[model samples]
Target: MTLLRHTSKEIKDRSALTINPAKTCQPVGAMYAALGIHGCLPHSHGSQGCCAYHRTMLTRHYKEPVYAGTSSFTEGASVFGGQANLLQAFQNIFEIYDPEVVAVHSTCLSETIGDDMPQIADKAVKEGKVPEGKVVVTASTPSYVGSHVTGFANMVQGMVKGLATKKDKKNGKINVIPGFVEPSDMGEIKRLCKLMDVPIILFPDTDGVLNGPLTGKHKMFPDGGVTVEELRDTANSMGTLALGEWGSSLAAKYLDSTHKVPCQILGLPLGLTATDSFIDALRKMAGKSVPAEISFERGQLVDVMKDYHQYLYRRKVALAGDPDQLIALTEFLVSLDMIPAHIVTGTPGKKFEERIREITKDVPYKVNVKVEGDMFMLHQWIKNDPVDLLIGNTYMKYIARDEDIPLVRHGLPILDRVGHQYFPTVGYKGGLRLLEKILDAILTRKDRDDPETSFELAL
Candidate 1:
């Protein structure tokens, strides 16, 4: 099936509108990145509603308590400035929450008003508002310019700038930035590193925080996230491995320039080739041979791919999500001989289309890829040209139902499903799980559509 059957090959100019965007605003991404740090309170230097929205979405997605502080801006603050409200917020946050660090992220309103965060932080220090050893970091995340991924990148870079130090010699510890994946994905990445005997420092880690077990008490600063001390030690690390160039490499680049930590940017390892590249990189970084356990995992994934080729081969699919995810996912689908007929993402990037085209240049059929595109446009394309499968966030379910097509939930804000918060989709093990889900969706459709006489005992 093809989703853009009626639409012409020639592209048209579009301006002044965006509908059902695949990406979200910046502050939410910054908040998620902040939660990866231990004992750190995320401070929103914007309206109370912005903070509430971010917290609510994160809580819904992760099914855990999401905590953040707001400056509680009013019309007065919006007009003149938010410096006063922020100063008060710092004092109250320290006195009430008492977190060891406060990560401040700016909003569109604050950025538009030109509030200097460093100046206000300095004032708070001079006025004795901040504790003696408490750390305060700021990230300029204006919501208007970029998507949530951009905000996440900005805050991560802020952490490197605000916390990392160079007091000791090179400690030979590798820095691994896992990108804006799930808490479960982060855990799996750490497990893989441990298996390779590689000592790594993973920042913005949210394993225990977002996926914490119920302990009969709610802790504002959950015992998850990167510790302040660990972040300070990142400067002494041997090198950096940044997964997903767009979402996870910004901080690595900053560290490389400022602290002399060599950085390697790689795609999120979602398929066989990508995962092999990731493992190879890890082996080189650790200066160790590939472990038997890791090799066995990779073999298992390949075995599943061979077994499921009958169902996946030649199946048409449409995918939408963040940039890096879409890139790796596209590679995975292509590896299965599945045609990614139509691809779309709300994040604005000139290189996204180019990279995707480069990967699909040899495919048999025409592959449509769009950057800064919305789901509405995708839906319209699907209306004109339908696909056998639709893979994306929960919002894509509506289109699936209307089009009578099978849908596979694959990206963020999966509001209506489970397992995403627990299972990973990065390493070889994750690849098997993703394959299972895709086969389940496609085979279920086949069983439902095939006639009773045509149905066989074996799949």
Candidate 2:
């Protein structure tokens, strides 16, 4: 079969550059995720605008304060260095926020100006600007190298490298590295672990911190996360499980190097195949059988799969989102017998491409995959070949509306909807959520086309 390609006019270089960019500026989302950890203060080492934009976006999506620090770079600071700005900010945050940990990430401007954040942060640490037992971790996530996904990965690496302690052995413990997933998903993962009777350490947890309920007053740091203790304990884990490709590298590498703990990289637990891999990994590492409760949940997911087979079979979908988001969604789509007619991600990586190819190999039709491609290209191909639904961030909202297709918001930002990060979309519970969204989109589109008077209630 021949694959249809978009013309330059259909996807022009400039106009097609990005009708709506699917991803956000790097450091913000990374900061948002980090803040979910209990007592973490995410510091943006750049201009105030970057920090403001990032905080505003998170607040809009999550309805939280989304606290963070800005270097407040001015003309003098930009050229000379942001050392002073960061030093002041560091002192201010520790004094004010008084969190146990501060996570520092670079913005585009700081990266362009060549600010030495590690040296600056180190100065703060050495001079006692940072308090006792309080830690500061730095990540060089220049936005130009990639998208928010890259920054998230870099920040994860930074956490493991900076905070994890050396020389220890901890039994009945496993390390879980969940990628850029929703806070609700993180909560469900923890819940499942508890039901399985497995002891584990989860990093960068945001379940309550990111999706906290309002009690009238704004908080600088929400009280939920992996804790500084968990970050330090990663090296001592019996084994490490990397959730997705992006956020798993650093911890896995560190554990291997320092603690000699084995690391297993698995896909986001979105579908049956990936979720099974996650549970099985845990069971083996713990030397325990699959708990009855988890087994029943799996059986229920299979029951729904049987029920939704006809509704999902042979459907075509357009997917555009973060790499981990797109990959997990694609895997889930295929499991339901949906064809991802087009897959697009802003972040460019070989593993992203290879994973897509591997997941779709068993499908009957050839699947189209594109990484590092913009939404303009995605829109062009969607026009070239019709699809049943679109799954991704709000950037695809306009395109889906124009084409009269249904769209489901999943992944970072989810600007068009509230509580996406708060809602669960992983494991068996998350699988059911995926099933509901897919069915809703498909049914909604069908209802629109069916004659108003002639449409039947029963399929």
Candidate 3:
């Protein structure tokens, strides 16, 4: 409660100030996106600290080895230019690391100085620093302009632009942009695609790369990741499914415009309705039926909802996370007849604000929504209008404790939890798990607050 001493319950306009940001910087997202590409080395084209911080954060979140290269900018590079540093990095990376692709992303320093990565890359290739047949892609990811999600989208678009090729023949394969979701969520999506019998090409797949096994040796480029071949064939796919407009739509839109591959933007498959939409989209795109197995999974989730609706009905809640996650999570909470009294995201966009407003319009209680916002504002809202449950990343735990509210961890950087790393939260099974966690939090609170005389074992 006292973590932010300067914060107050009174909501005021502070045009330039942002505290406890819900989203991280851009280069981190770029690094994560690069991990999804097979034999692709993520190179940070800025100060070494930026790369170090990104690698640390990603490593902590996934509890796995995150391998990335850096331009290792110095004072001279910062004052003059980083082109020489990057060119040298390219030579060293190609010669030593020997990755098939180098996914380069810019930082605040490079972008501020207007470093032309493309030109530098071209020079490197011409100077014979870049090996033939190897690839070098770049994304303009200034930390000042957009959040990590935007960086992820930009890097993915860069990957497509650099690697995807239009062939004469069209393949039945469907391209899936999984967005900035967990490795587990990516794996779950692949599972759902397989069950639907859809020949899908999921880009930036960090399945085994980010969530790899405890092998004796560490692989710089993990076994998991969309291969170069897969990326090349993406342009020849029948269509593309981009989940989460904020984190994925840009790349999908780019692919559509450039390659004539039609694109459909869908929310992350979280709740029953969202999952249904995803399944329906798959069915239509694949020209096939939803397999009975998938239906059974849906049925199981519905069964859980039916059994637990009483526990969750009309429960007031507060939520904070990325835009795509907030949208899907809000929808899921609303489906349970839960009041998402407060919602916030640090990622700035009119679209995010509009979507949130549109979602909460029908709610009985007033919903406090903010974009380009901070956690301090969310905490102030919670202080003013206390909620029964707080749902967000582990950062919300501080507020939950001070307010004595139950909390369900449901977003990125879940530093303290284990399941968010390995368990699925994107499909029917994911819905079931979400329902279970919410119920567990609510009921545990109920049990803790109930009078001793009125406490019933069954209830």
Name the runs in model 2 displaced over 4 angstroms.
1-19, 452-454
Ranking by lDDT: 3, 1, 2
Model 1: per-residue lDDT, tens digit, 141-229? 99998799999889998899888898659887899998888898898899999999999999889888888888798788888788999
Cα lDDT tens digits for candidate 2, 2-88? 122232336455633554566666797578657756788899988899988988877777776688888989899888888899999
- The residue-by-residue lDDT of candidate 3 on 343-448, one tens digit each, is 9998878898888778878889899998888888999999899888988888888887777888898877787778877888899999888888988898888888
TM-score of each: 0.96, 0.94, 0.98
Off by over 4 Å in 3: 1-6
Quality of model 2 by C-alpha lDDT:
0.80
RMSD of 1: 2.8
Error of 2 at 82 (Å): 1.1
Badly placed stretches (over 4 Å) of model 1 are: 1-13
- What are the lDDT figures for the candidates, one per model? 0.89, 0.80, 0.90
Highest-scoring model, lDDT: 3
Q: Candidate 1 — which pairs collide? A: 3-385, 36-225
